[model samples]
Target: MLPLALLAGVATQLRAEEPRPAATTDFAGLILHLSEDPGKFHSDNFVSNEPGYPSAIEGLRALGIHGGAYIGVGPEQNFSYLAALQPERAFVVDIRRENTVQHLMYKALFAAARNRLEFLELLLSRPPPNAPEGESSRAAMSVQELLTAVDSRGASMKACEQTIDSVSARIEENFGFPLTDKDRVTLRHIHSAFAEAGLSIHYSSPKAVKQEPTLRELMLARDTYGNHVHFLASEKDFQFVKQLHARDRIVPVTGDFAGRQALRKAGEFVRDRGEVVSAFYLSNVEQYLRGAQYAAFVENVRRLPLNDRSVLIRCAFEKPTQRLPGDHSEQADGQFWPHALLLQRAQRFVELYDEGAFLTHEDLARQDYLDWTSGR
Candidate 1:
């Protein structure tokens, strides 16, 4: 269980010393400027529901896809991708203002912690048992070992309250993003959920039928090749994300994919900076768009500048009688997700729309998943 401490970019070139993202002088103002007004309804998933998210990383690397800009939705799962892709900057757009506020909570956590163990410490509100101080030593530890070393005691009301205060202060004083009373309440509610559940927390949905993996399972999860690739899995991955957050390279925006302003404005910013999106993780939000909304989303995606190597990382679940076309076990299904971890050319996506291939959401979902070997 959690100790109750609760939580919590660059799109750049492929090189290790790649240039960082253009300066973000105003984080909150930029969020407002880039955001569309919140829709009437939105998914309230604070944590990622997708356990198979990392499977795409293996394919991403194998295809020589790395760095540029990453666009995604939902929660901490984006951290895992940021660790892998190391984009110059990222725009994590969701339809709800709560999502942006949630990202701010995460940003504060990232700013507070320095290493993987420290990150886990803040995340679970558990102090490190005997964490190593050396970067190399922490890098040598696996996620399982690192998490095992975290304090197992449940959270104290005092500690939980302190974290809430500290996180709010950090966002205001350090990051310059003030939290409204309502936002603070939402942040507290989200953090309280984390404290009550700790590492055992899993995505909850009224519509969920099967058990989703816990936070611990997701952290310990590996890519298709049996390599643990989640952000907290390695100290290096953790720091990559941490440093990026410190620089304000990752941003959150509110927008319905079908709505105007959000994606187009975000794309405009990236384009103005001469950056192109390399990968986009849509989860299963596409399943929610219908008719005109779906068409508007396709049009919005078309506005983003993309490169040949750019790809879309999406999910589709298996059916009782008809499984998605892949031998991989990285599949999830219920209502939202329709298939497993899927990778397809980003250019191909817009091309398909131009070719009049996606008359419906099913047509978009029915498009072929990229074969792994052909790119290599």
Candidate 2:
């Protein structure tokens, strides 16, 4: 076992070995992949230790992501720890880490910009016709309206642009790091892919998970912009939770009083929004069902409509809280898979859904045309 000081020393030594990491791209285009998982763990955790830590890079290389970035929460996860390990093979980015206060401000600002855009769209579609004579209008009211409208257009455009620019500038001003264009493009690509795949993923913080309606409408709109879009819920919110008996078929008790409720809410939310919603339990459902319940849970999941295109599952093991080890939701730690592993999973999602392939409007409009129609 490494002493705390020794581990800290090793971390320092790694930076000294390579002051600057290598770049993964060679001009073809960014081999885009994203991972929302945090990398914190015990000193001995597989992902933190050597050998296991490198598997993520291996996975991305396997997926042909030679030059791309891995997105994480903070500098600790973004800097040397992960990127240094793969040195130059990948770029690491730490997106916004603000809590709800600052997040709401950004959201309000984005809404204002989006509203301004809509107003412009409407104005362009139908320019006001010339004012009728004797309408108490100036002789050049129409022309003036056009010029005033032009000036208004410029002001509103600047206002909308400034909202994003100022917010981004303020963030960089305070944090000393600006949001990179690559980061913005990565998010747009993900959201576009998800939308094309027919999955509606919301971009919001844990505190604002209830904004599903807003997220859905945003996705529906032509322009959806953001750097970080997360699908998470506040465990404290009753509106986000549903009560379930331990005996419920979809939820297997894992020793926590809240386990049944969490599982129940996830299952019910997925089912209730059927057809209109694309929901997936990305956590390791297999590991969450332990001992006597694991077999039953696995068996039931196979029978469920899990393989449907609208659903996705990415399983990873985690540490269970109780002395009794095995599959248990409470034990789940997200860091079991590094950024590379998460990126591979995202690629698998694209392949699994056959996204980005040509599909006509008629084909898409066919309600039953799912990827698994061939029975894979």
Candidate 3:
């Protein structure tokens, strides 16, 4: 075997020689690819402005995830994780094409805005509060203060519509990605959701029968030990995501997790850049995957570049009595709630696959992978 120092040097040399995705075409290609794919698109809006899932920061931090590629499904929660992980690149894949359009809208706003406050101003269709003209002035305002400023001004339907149209047009004209009529209409509704609701937009599930927490509440939510883990909870956290957006590092792709094309192509792109997958956030999608779909997803994941440190973040819903290690929950009015976010090493999943141990979602969920760092 090669010496440790020699192996490290060789790895660094190989990374230096790899080709990176071009800034102009990387995002455009991802958008166009989703447009061409055959994945089923949902019509109704599935906007998740806040993370409805459990927090995985403790696991990610323990795994030392940084400066690598991130893959996940869903909305703004991805930005929060990206802010924390500071990945070189990120791909947000969802079955619904509307999600892709929503991300495109975000990309346009990020390209247009100069900072966190400016981004909020454009997103909420409201002006910023009067403050000194400097970075310190903006940073001094807390997340609550920012929300209050936005809510103080009622949603301006006319102004918000104009801004949305202008940004949508810029996305097509400047970014070179064409948007369909339906996409434009859908984008407008998404913008209205944020503008009208401000930070109070709650997580609305298609299958939900009851009310859920708003985005603001989720951001301020603490873990069992009273720790703030949401991405926008701090100015430093907000700046981290803003900088990543400014650099065009976050790309949204519309593809099913079990599909043949998207994840495979993403793996190819990461491999060409000589980077490994640091973390993947699978937000309760596995619960709906059938046998064939589950197998296909595992096969696709096998194609991605990963190491022992590569981790899978999964969310599961169980009874409060059936909680796993590191699981966090809250009790409301004496009702038991069981929501678990688990992190496991990628290699362990590969092992389970080889042994035919993952025949069902329950099989995958019941494992003690939550104790991910014990054997390592």
Candidate 4:
């Protein structure tokens, strides 16, 4: 193992980007071909905890970010970026095989439902949306109202049981991708977590010392203009992601950022398809990429096809030094908000590294990035 230092000789070996031959295959074959074997990660991130991710929408739009390949880490958070950018294609790359398995669960959910409300029914294990009872037509309700209605009804263990079986069947029918027994088990476990917890499920369980934001809160979150911006915020946004998943355009791969193969293969796939990666949701993965690993990660990034408009989406998080009223929800919940999404020019990242500006993670969070986000 290398110490936490980048060797100058390794830096000197960086070469210009080159294209790799495209593999001709369907969605299942593509996933199996592109992904590395299962790797280990510490947490079970079934739902995202980034409450302030809507700010990323405003930032990306401000920077004219849109339409190309979208690469991201984590669970469902990438959906919001997909909705905003309307990317031509997407890849969710993470070290955990569980993350990839969970994505298969999501693919099943999207495939089962037609619109946003029906999608929620399949997710929370609610009985199918029925005749007008307590609420009006499902289409008439706002995102907030839909979430509130679902939250009021307790999760049905009976429905959850049925949901798990259906998800398993759907995976076999739709994708036709062969999953290992462990992968199938992981898929069912992830689905059960969402159904049992309903909208209240979070990054960690609710009983933890620091309670994280719930799925309901995350979906209800708003952009800088106070417009709801999560993936389920609007019917159009929801449909965009739904169709993509049904078509298997959004692929999830178990890939270690610092390791070999996965990312490099993804870059090659993008290059061969003639698609440029417009937005990449880093989500603080750089914090873990130090020393030679960081250098290797940077090299992997440089392999992607990019244009001048491409940007990297990252979230900045911390523990408060003193009790300050920055955001009311954190104080009220007695938990820290692990996010405020920030943007950096993808090309600028490579340029800054060459200039010796990104020696530390702190250096990645400079004010100039803020300026760049604002078009200053």
TM-score of each: 0.86, 0.21, 0.84, 0.85
| Model 1, residue 108: C-alpha shift (Å) | 0.9
Residue-level lDDT of model 1, residues 1-376, one tens digit each, is 0000111011111222233233234987788788765543322475776676766777787778787888888789999989889888999987666678789888988888767777666766777557767877877887777877774466666767888889988877777775666677888988878877888787766555666677887787666567888888877888888888888789998766666787888888989999999998887676656666667878888888988888988775534244433324544333233336778898888888788887765565567567675533
Pairwise lDDT winner, candidates 1 and 2: 1
In candidate 4, position 81 carries an lDDT of: 86
lDDT agreement of model 3 with the native: 0.68
Compared with the true structure, all predictions reach lDDT values of: 0.72, 0.24, 0.68, 0.72
Off by over 4 Å in 3: 1-26, 34-54, 128-133, 320-322, 332-337, 372-376
- Residue 182 lDDT in model 1? 66
Candidate 2 — worst ten consecutive residues by lDDT sum?
238-247
- Candidate number of the best TM-score: 1
Model 2 CA deviation exceeding 4 Å by range:
1-258, 262-289, 292-307, 315-376
For model 4, state the Cα shift of residue 323 in Å. Answer: 17
For candidate 3, the per-residue lDDT at 308 reads 81
What ranges in model 1 sit over 4 Å off?
A: 1-25, 40-43, 130-136, 318-339, 374-376
Model 1 TM-score?
Answer: 0.86
Tens-digit lDDT track of model 4 for 81-166: 89999988899987666787788788888988776777788788865443235323655668877776666567777877887888
* lDDT, model 3, position 111: 76
Please give the ranking of all candidate structures by TM-score, highest first, separated by commas. 1, 4, 3, 2
Ranked candidates, highest lDDT first: 1, 4, 3, 2
Off by over 4 Å in 4: 1-25, 128-136, 205-209, 318-338, 370-376
Model 2 — TM-score against the truth?
0.21
